[model samples]
Target: MSNKTIKIGQLDMELQSIFSAFEHHVHTAVDTAAEKTAEEAVKKLKKTSPKNKRAKRGKKYKNGWKYKKTSEGMTVYNEQYQLTHLLENGHDIIINGEVRGHAAAHEHIAPVEAWAQDEFPEEFKRQVGKG
Candidate 1:
């Protein structure tokens, strides 16, 4: 008899099933870790010196602003999910939106000048810094 053998039984199918199960488990673990890290960062930011909860408000729009269309002709309104905070330095920071625990969340503050500049360029200039 030849030394080579082919298994036409359940073993081949079971091996493939085991690998697929492992792949799913790893994917879940990685996703959970990333989400938890982001949540922790938000928690830390909220716990800084002020130690007071902020109130919710509507999006602050600039005066005389008109809606413009994107290249694809989608009307671009300054629709953003944002949280606004006043800092000791008299500047504003508006954070981009995120889904937190099945609800939309936006956390922003005045001290985060760099993030405000980079993330919300148009709003930052008009609202916070020199326009």
Candidate 2:
């Protein structure tokens, strides 16, 4: 019996191509998932944000909510003013060196955290397929 040898160069090339495609797929999937999650978080924050009663009668905190994609992940933020931190965390309202009262925390980030916890893993799994 004669033994035959086979070259796997073509097979290797095919595998490399498949892997490249898979990598691109993963990147796209992650980006899409992150974008969707960020948008959802913004929506949730807008809906739940406490309205500024002191502002113009029909003014809404919802209008402040915005989102953008970041290198590490996604970011949801408020654009109305730099008051998101103050609104999310209770702060003392001081007047003329007098402490008036504490503003209650609205906690916009908490909902985003909760949403990411529920969404990210599921989205990754669905996009990339089971590891």
Candidate 3:
């Protein structure tokens, strides 16, 4: 390699361009990984969510899983927002304003959360490696 000398202003511009390209690359990889994880979380949630097969209108919690792209980042959520926490953590079954028994939690979101914690890092590495 031949040695070259550059002026200060030119050096600054060159460094800026190089940094910009690198920043773009890193951001693209991170965004791709986040999107993949979000999609997978939705799919897994749909699979694991409780469903009422007998419902005439077929309004199942499994079908309520959704993902959103936000200014902050990706997000996976249930369209049946009110039921998520109750279903996940279980709640007392009440009848006529009196407690009867407890409903067992199905444990859907927790498992997906555990999976994502492991999945995101691997996905990011794979995406970056694609370069």
Candidate 4:
């Protein structure tokens, strides 16, 4: 990347390569930031995830939180997939296929999501600075 003053044959190619490299650098930084933020969210979710002692379940949902990288980006999921939405948003108490009542929503995901939303930018900045 010179001054781009006088006419140069390789100037265009050089500029393209430079820009592409910078783009790649930024993309890597973003991905790093996304992963860190996602990990933080997963940890927070695990800590805050509810443990229903009364239910004769195998274990607490606390340990099931995990994050994965998708084509779109990072995705946080519970290994206990069947209970995630039900626990987060509350569910209808069904008895033999009949809705009897509603379970109270014990919000464990939303707060972490909000924190991630606020944390990603800072994490991106930190990653880029390190780069």
Listed per model in order, the count of residue pairs whose N, CA or C atoms clash below 3 Å is 0, 0, 0, 0
Model 3: ten consecutive residues of lowest lDDT: 51-60
- How big is the positional error of residue 127 in model 1, measured in Å on the Cα after superposition? 42
- What are the Cα lDDT values of the candidates? 0.37, 0.77, 0.89, 0.89
- What would the per-residue lDDT of candidate 3 be over residues 29-57, giving only the tens digit for each residue? 99999999999999999888887668774
- Whichever of 1 and 4 has more lDDT, that candidate is 4
Cα lDDT tens digits for candidate 4, 43-108? 899888888888777355778888999999999988889998899999999999999999999998
As a whole number from 0 to 100, the lDDT of residue 107 in candidate 1 is 34
Weakest 10 consecutive residues, lDDT, candidate 1?
Answer: 57-66
Clashes, model 1: 0
Worst 10 residues of 2 by lDDT: 1-10
Where model 3 places Cα greater than 4 Å from the true spot, the runs are 1-9, 57-59
Native-to-model Cα distance after best TM-score fit, residue 51 in candidate 2, in Å? 0.6
RMSD in angstroms between candidate 3 and the native structure over all alpha carbons: 2.5
RMSD of each: 18.4, 5.2, 2.5, 2.8
Itemize residue pairs with steric clashes in candidate 3: none
Error of 2 at 68 (Å): 1.3
Candidate 1 local lDDT, 14-130, one digit each (tens): 678878876776555544443343333334344432322443431132111123334532122222212122222233334465433332223333333343234343432343222
TM-scores for all predictions: 0.33, 0.82, 0.87, 0.82
